[model samples]
Target: MAETELVCANRECRIAQGGRCIEGHDDLAKCLYYGNEPEEGDQNEADDDQEVIAPFNGVYLPDAHPLDSRRADRVLASLPSRMIGVIGVHDSGKTSVIAGLFDLFQMGPVANIIFAGSSTLHGLEIICHDARAASERDEPHSERTKRGEVRFYHFDVLRDGLLQSLLIADRSGEEYEEVADLAANATTMFELRRADVITVLVDGRRLASSRDRADVMGAIPLIIQGMAENGAFSRKPNLAIVLTKDDAVQASTRKDQVQRDFLAIIDGIRDAFASHFGEIGSFVTSASPKDANVVRGAGLAEMLEFWMKPGAEAQGIRQHSYSGRVFDSLMIEEAKRG
Candidate 1:
């Protein structure tokens, strides 16, 4: 390299070497230091002004994802966690319920429980996107869980100052329904065997139609029966028969009759599976509602509280109300306000 003195004061200018301003100025007169002498500064000061880049010491990690079946056990081994398994037929709003709870935490404390933290923020955000105005969709919807792509979302919450870890499993409803055909189908769904709370969703929209009501009401028992035959319940976990899409049912003409049918179905499930479950409960929830009359995330408080604390004698459908916790609860007042 030939040693050449700079023609301008600006250290960045390469006019002497390239016959043009390195700063890309169109006119020579326009250059700030075009006709000025370069400053004689301390070598240290020149070194300090130069950009210094550090070496690439660390590798980039991928975005956080929901826990897989293999990883679920590892998390459970490290932390004292509770596993929640949500089961339903296709389009039963199973995924929406999980997404709604995550949405509630974004506001503040739900049912008064603090929004502590989540392991799968990306997964939750993906499910929640379509329901928000940012998605640019006219009607809100939940992204359906793909078959065989089961994942478990984790939430670490403070319950009365005690950090309670929760692992909520998500999978396609079609997969769960497969267990009804053969008990062996549940072998792939090992989460069910270890679940502390098993929530079976009843689609309120299906219940609204007389044609679909009977079949919809009958589906839950078959799921339970097959799982039971598979020895899915080694220990009796608390059972929550959640009536999802309450807003849809609210907007229907058969609202009253649907509610009646829901109760009857609950009673039947209780009597049939009472021996297999620790505490049998029924809850009504509308995660994201189309009807203005029905509140978003309605009745999730009771459902969550019930899941947290077992041995509740839940005989009927839980109303959309939040009762404070003497023990741990979801203090859902803030979430319900929306």
Candidate 2:
């Protein structure tokens, strides 16, 4: 103090005079900088940035639905029969949903279908084979890698007393785009084209995703439009727009935001067809395996239930759709006619 020492400007410098460092740290020469705060305008710009929307509010029903006497009697009397094709974009859980339905059907929880393998009655034993993708290169037929692998299995049933088994033909996700022509033919000219019902399982997350929505919607229009225009889905076949992965849709408090997002997507798809088809039933479901998370599994089932027969009702068999029942009845009529 007596010598009037000048402290170095560097915060860590111990030098008593000017800008020189007394600590002998060679890096002091590069420390001539001050931290500056962001300008106020930049903060304002950040406020306008887009925000990610939250998921939708999904419904979950309890197990073991109570039966409706009148409805059950009526449905059984008519006994819905038809080749119901379930389809959707890749990773849409079409196979999972079918598996779950099979589980339910075997348990006799859903409708009582005439199961094959028993020597009691006569009905079709449906085969569910996942067609693999055909290889591009010169690979042996055995070596030809399955482009798309089927996900579900085939079941046999005799439709003597109830609606027999369903032959679940699983086409791999890889084939979704490539098989549009096949799907179209399936809906239009194939034997199942005359199906009494058609269940299209759509992936909720994919449909909700802003990225994939457009392309997916684009791929489906031709098939659906062709189906409707060619009198395939026009039988007023009780159409079930089964939504897979409902848990993802409802795992948040941001349903308003998510619904708007999905609504836009669905509307876009609807617009693509341009009033070509009527409003089909909508359902959300989660068909992940036992180990799969509950949210995903339950969510998918919920979505599917919303638009389908039993799930569409008030959370039970009592609340099934008469339209769905009617659809089943029509299919049975078609089968009987055949």
The best candidate in terms of lDDT = 1
- Which prediction has the highest TM-score against the true structure? 1
Q: Each prediction's Cα lDDT score? A: 0.82, 0.45
List TM-score per model, in order: 0.74, 0.45
In terms of lDDT, model 2 sits at 0.45
Candidate 2 structure quality by residue, lDDT tens digits, 221-282: 55566456555543444455665666555664544555665555466555665343334555
TM-score between candidate 1 and the true structure: 0.74
lDDT of 1 by residue, 72-161 (tens): 777788666788989999999988898888888888888767767777888889888988879998888887888776789988888788
Error of 1 at 180 (Å): 1.6
Error of 1 at 136 (Å): 1.1
